[model samples]
Target chain A: MKFRSMLAALAVLVLGAAQAQEPIRIGSFLAVTGGAAFLGDPEQKTLELYVERLNAAGGVLGRKLQLIVYDSAGDAEKARTFAKRLIEQDKVDVIVGGSTTGETMAMVPLVEAAGVPFISLAGAVVIVEPVKKWVFKTPHSDRQACERIFVDMKARGATKVALISGAGGFDKSMRAQCLQVAKNHGIEIVADEAYGTGDTDMTAQLTKIKNTPGVQAVLNVGFGQSPAIVTKNHKQLGISQPLYQSHGVASKAFIKLAGDAAEGVRLPAAALLVAETLPDSDPQKKVVLGYKREYEARFKSEISTFGGHAWDGLMLAVEAIRKAGSTDKAKVRDALESIRGFVGIDGVFNMSATDHVGLDISGLRMLEIRKGDWTLVK
Target chain B: MSGRTASLATLAGIVLLLPLALQNNYYYEVAIQVGLNAIVCVGLNLLIGYAGQISLGHAGFFGLGAYGSAILTARYGWPPLAALASATAGVAVLAYLIGRPILRLRGHYLAMATLGMGIIISIVIATEDRLTGGPDGMPVPALAAFGAALSGERVWYWVVGATLLAAVWLALNLVDSPHGRALRALHGSEVGAEVTGIDSARHKVKVFVISAVYAALAGSLTAHYAGFVTPAKVTFFHSIELVTMVVFGGMASTFGAVVGAAVLTVLPQALTVFKEYEMVVFGAVMMLTMIFMPRGLVPTLALTLSGRRLPR
Candidate 1:
């Protein structure tokens, strides 16, 4: 009779714990409307769609998911202000956003002080360098992009390279990173040419590169219209040297804009670009194909790797919350740090204490643009 | 004089009691931004309203002040307070030198000159990657005194709030002074003011320098408070935003400028409730506000409240 009564009491306590309604809050500040909208728009959509699906699956630890997104419009000050609101007012359990390096760095001090786990979607190495306790990122850093390009160039037996960069933040940072790592790869920078932010014509700089001798390959370290313009100018000038680009131009829009000139142009980017082309045995293939299919089906837009970064970030946060089995801030952060062998869209993340951004040189894949589509270089 | 004293006392009371209503650090951040913008707008109002001059490049002075103090304390090892003062004084000198020549041009020509100047400053800041950390922006050290870092949102609120009060006080006094009268006369008509021996050129130059100083001081304080500096504020869009705040607050009114700063600063954050329609709604609100009030929020409301004849 005592055993039966005790069993009834245990059932009542367990049922009560699962019946609570307080939702786990995930806060985000993205550049959804302004300068960096192309990146933030897809990211916002992915997060919203996935969060709905997670909640539909009866959420982690038996709690619903609440996502609060604030668009910073690519403004650093606005990013900081929205971060404060997210922390103090919303009291979110985890933060998994920051589209630009500027916005990411701006929110670093706040999240660290508040002791919230922040997973940055920004591509700057500075976001994870020196390893602040509360910050992690899902994107490959610009330095890694530079190092990867150099190693590829070395393998191709290209001893000399001409860098044509635009003055945008990413362009300049990648250019510097390339310069920093060229010596290590035994590559020499033959000519360094730069175009202003809004310059549509780069034939002037292309002519200079064309005249420079011993330049075996030309690399443009820019993303926006300028890189496409450089591609056209590279073709118009009839310079047959192999062309390379940064991962910044890893979008279908670049192919549409560059058209015939995009043929044979090489760049390093995440495997999410060629998700459908991956083998069945690959671990990341399933995750990448799942995201691409769902996103394409829902948003009716071609998937870009920028959105893949957000997918990685959000899933990591959700996994951490699940691992902790509770919404405790300190415990969740610890769970995030201890995450191992997790496969996501960005890379197979292996986070450790010293390295906040766990994906290394192997995460990036080299691709050649053939007939206006991305093909694995093998 | 009594009215001015009363306004100052009221401002003081509000500043002291505002902390009670602040729920947390988020409110303090918004409040601090409002204070900083108000300091710049108050000085800007003196030039645009009292002097009838338009500056499309005030952000250049503000950016210069920000980068100056940031580089001074971080690179040169100067004390924070000293760097702030020096940056302000440097901008004052630059404004005075350029104002004499640039103020000679009137109306659209003057506007063009200032616009060109702002563009030049922004370009230089972006290009000089070595010293200024290029386009990615540089980190600013925390405001320190006597070898101790004076940090935290609440502490900055007191500092910026006190500075904003001082800026308004100075603007009010200037408007009531002899120079202020001259500026107002010049705004009415340069020839008429010159006929009355108002020295329109000199008064214009002095007020220009004064306004630039205000922007520089606010910019320096903002750099220290945010603990980061970027060229984002130095752009032409930011200068236009400042002008919009001045016009929105009701030109020539010090308290109106403060209200304008607060409203515009808070509106963007509040409009997030509308989600995707934020920019559209922001534009609509700005348009409707301008359509109805015309003289801006404070002045139109003041006239309505006092039962005065609406100015045609």
Candidate 2:
């Protein structure tokens, strides 16, 4: 039996060698530097590292992966231009990576027109709302984050809430989405307050939320350092009501920045953060642990869910290419849409003709900061 | 050919021949961006290079033009061309009003004033979520004529290329005119220009308005071309980049401004192959160029080609 299995493995390797050919070109444009670097930097690293690993493991469809990344620095025009370069000049078979909704939306027309498959890592509903044929994304939209938070709120019996958001693009978009869906979620936004970008403190806004009567929970709908400051201020003001944050602050840096203030704060994030704690029976355990181990061992940095989005994006493109058995753009696009129950770092995606994002609010696991680390909330 | 005709012919030749060198849509996209930046830099050259005045808020006027055209065509349902014209005209009037008062502040004070103005405009665009779409920005209606949308990189290359040539011709003529000499006179010394019946204040305001108009027109064209506009274009960093292009290409030289815009526009795209070290290499290149050719790219090269000895 051992000898028979060895022979089978040798036969498969030989067949794979025969099928292997040129590298399957994957072009990506990300905001790898400048203002949105937090999102783009990790994403770039994930793509580069995994593509190298896949190539070493005999690649997808016996063809190696070639990833060419351009940093757009969150500039929309540059993103559009880079998309053109990726399509027209690089002649990439598949494209993935857009770190901001503005960048993703800017490239939407060009990719759709050129008949290229693009999977974005940005967060926004507009990219897939009308459901353009060629355009898709990996990151859960801001609406999904809002809905997931509301589910937790509903479970906790929180009816009245106060919304405090920062004046950044993601912050405002998430704030708007939460407001749009609040009534449906059975949550009432009693007080709505905002702060300017680069504001050192958010205590004044926290004070107002605290003063608002019957405010059962205070939701901070923002990302980056602002949310951290919001968390810190919520603790500073000693408001005991549950303080929930958006998926924007899912990274470990949030806990480090907010420190002890982050305790008991709940936000929606991927299960990859608590990979070690996940049961072996969990479907995501294998892939999540593999990704977390590879990234941590290689980069020596704490993993961010932003990087997980890129991992899902690259792997999805690879799987579609494998399913199509060729680099044919249309076939690969169809394969991507038809992919069902494919577990990824983000979620178990089941893409369809109408729903390109695939992962719903359920994909985003509710995680709470406990003892300065993410603890999966049951 | 005369100096004016020679420079214009050289610019026209390159613009005509650029398409052949462009292999595909990607090349055309980069070329289009270069042309747009060149047009704005030409106007900026007139202000900083020839007139010796400074504007750190130049991008504010550019942003206002973009947002103005975007809102008018997309939100109000006006025609694209009409929106572009109105936006440019509005910015010109605004610039005139602003220039009359702020032009009086000489040197660093004027710089500070313009910088503050730019910050204010950026903030307004970022905060005015109802109209400007806040920091996330808004999609713009494409420039169309007679029902056909004027889209695609190939078509835009010619449009922008032709517009750039026309702008150069106008600038070349204006620079050689008495008004041009008046600008130079004021650049030398405001009191000296006024003593010679140059009406330094009037000339300063006129050139400022003209430059602002140029920036506004380019901004509107950019909005329509890309079909998107963000407050990112209106930021202080953008203003600094524009100024750097004017200075880097060689102030007071039209061809230099075009070269600076072209090289800088293409540099970042070309440097992507460097991967992790792209920014470091980019910064190093800029530093070396400034150190080696202190007079900027064009003037230094022009001086050498003419076999002129160094003054010092």
Candidate 3:
């Protein structure tokens, strides 16, 4: 009896060791439980979608992909620590997805040292700039968004514009780029103002922008209540000039929060949210509609650019793994760089090592809220 | 030896050996943060413990210092060390100006005033995108001193440790001096201390300004070390966290502040195993600690170990 028990114990130990070595784990650090839950909850769903789809098509290198996610509450320092733990302890094959640029950059050093591919969802050029081989991004960079907004603004005849943005990661970069883009395009930015995360009133800044001479339009950047602030306050102050919002405010939440004031607010958005507005014959239309149907059916919530970012990040990572035919970071990164004509929910992705930003201005469609409904303006 | 002296000696020895002992970059990172928290809490303890004043808006000073340094370095191309000095000086001036009127109020009024200061700073930091980089806060110029940039966890650990040690030593010296005693006397009974010839209002304002400088210096160090600063660093939440460390460690004891900061910092990391439940457990522990041992972890633990319960 004692001999039999010893043999069984040895067998169990062997099984445990083999099971541990079976699969490559991918770590996802998101704001899953914090103020950014509106963003991270969908991020978790997209990650799951990737995992399921990858497994359905025969797992990466015949090894089932394991995903580990942590909630950093959109805190950069916390994200950094979580990234380290994921690399060192969880032993993830790659680190994917971050809620904010601050959180994503915080992971750069650790993931680089750990020799894992880090694909960020945050729209910061710094995330992939001076491009480390191990670091790549799937989101449109802040610079691209800035260029797109200005290009659209100039096209729309918004020459003299006032700028107001929330003092958040994406908005900060976007605002800087907007100013540079304005200088290049000869778009006179009359007034520039800012606000914080939890601010409810932006009357002072909005008032300043309203009072600025020759301000034909307002370029509102940042996320959360800031966009809502511009929307409501602009109407209240009777500043009927054109309002151009950053992609950060391209959300149903913004509309809901801003009430009737959200009407007639033009913003740049990925084609995913308003895919139905595109003709059925459009190739990108089918994939986006499919995601919209599936996402609404499952999550019962409206999709936003934020979720579209997650969808793109997750799908791209899965595609790279499949193309690489292995969980190896080097191979996966090469495959990611080589991605061509990949129709994602966000945009048609064509990534290369030199250009980690898969989608550019072409992929983004101009969206406007007209009478509390999202309409494709261009 | 007095418990304070012994605790200070132990802290000094630990800090001295910390860089050598912690070879891991992760630990170095945590230690660097602990040092930063210790600096903030030590400054906060001056107001809460010695002067018996509360400022819920200390984070405003911290934010101003961080944003001041970040903008100076990033926009003006000022050297980081020079920026740090200028930022600290700027905050000191701002604090004195803001505190002159606000500190006159007592208790909740004072708390509310400080809270307003924090809110105003946050608003300014958030809105002034042209100047402060707005709510996303600006990236700090890397901590460069004498032409070399301070990067990596190991270097930051030493710099922060030395700064924290100096702060503690300064605070310790102040607490031991006649000025500290006068502050303490004022804390115990303002009228009595005034009767005993301590300039109650002057001492309060002085301690308030001193504490603000400490917070500002700590904020500058934090921004330089992290190579970034956001308004979140000086938000009300951060102020509350600093106050928590001071009160949780034993409000009157400077060593208690350090211990509180260290324990709270490490606790969250250790409790990461609980995952989402960690927050719940953290809240529970905090509540229970405050309810049962209001003097804080260090004093309560000391008292227990000495086979004496805290006097009701």
lDDT of 2 by residue, A1-378 (tens): 234335536855885676556578899999988989998999999999999999899888877787889999999888999999889877899999889988988889888899999999989888899999999899888999999999899999998999999889898898999999999999999999999888989989889889999999999988778889999899999999999998888887788899999999999988888899987889999999999999999999988889999999999999999899999999999999999999998889999999998997767899988899888898
Residue A195 error for model 1, in Å? 1.3
User: Could you tell me every candidate's TM-score relative to the true structure?
Assistant: 0.96, 0.95, 0.85
Q: Rank candidates by DockQ, best first.
A: 2, 1, 3
Interface RMSD of each: 12.9, 12.7, 9.3
Candidate 1 residue B221 C-alpha distance from true site, Å: 0.4
lDDT of 1 by residue, B1-312 (tens): 998999889988988999887768988898899999999999999999889999999999999999999999888988999999999999999999999999999999999999999899999988887777767678888989888887999999998889988998989999999999999999999999999988888999999999999999999998999888878899999999999999998888888888888889888877776789988999999999999988888889989998998977
Candidate number achieving the greatest DockQ relative to the actual structure = 2
Question: In candidate 1, which residue ranges exceed 4 Å CA deviation?
Answer: A1-19
By DockQ thresholds, what CAPRI class is model 3? incorrect
Cα RMSD of all models vs. native, in order, equals 6.2, 6.4, 5.3
Choose 2 or 3, whichever is better by lDDT: 2
Between candidates 2 and 3, the one scoring higher on TM-score is 2
lDDT order of candidates, top first: 2, 1, 3
Give the C-alpha miss distance for residue A2 in model 3, angstroms: 34
- DockQ, each predicted model: 0.34, 0.40, 0.18
Model 3 chain A lowest lDDT segment of ten: A1-10
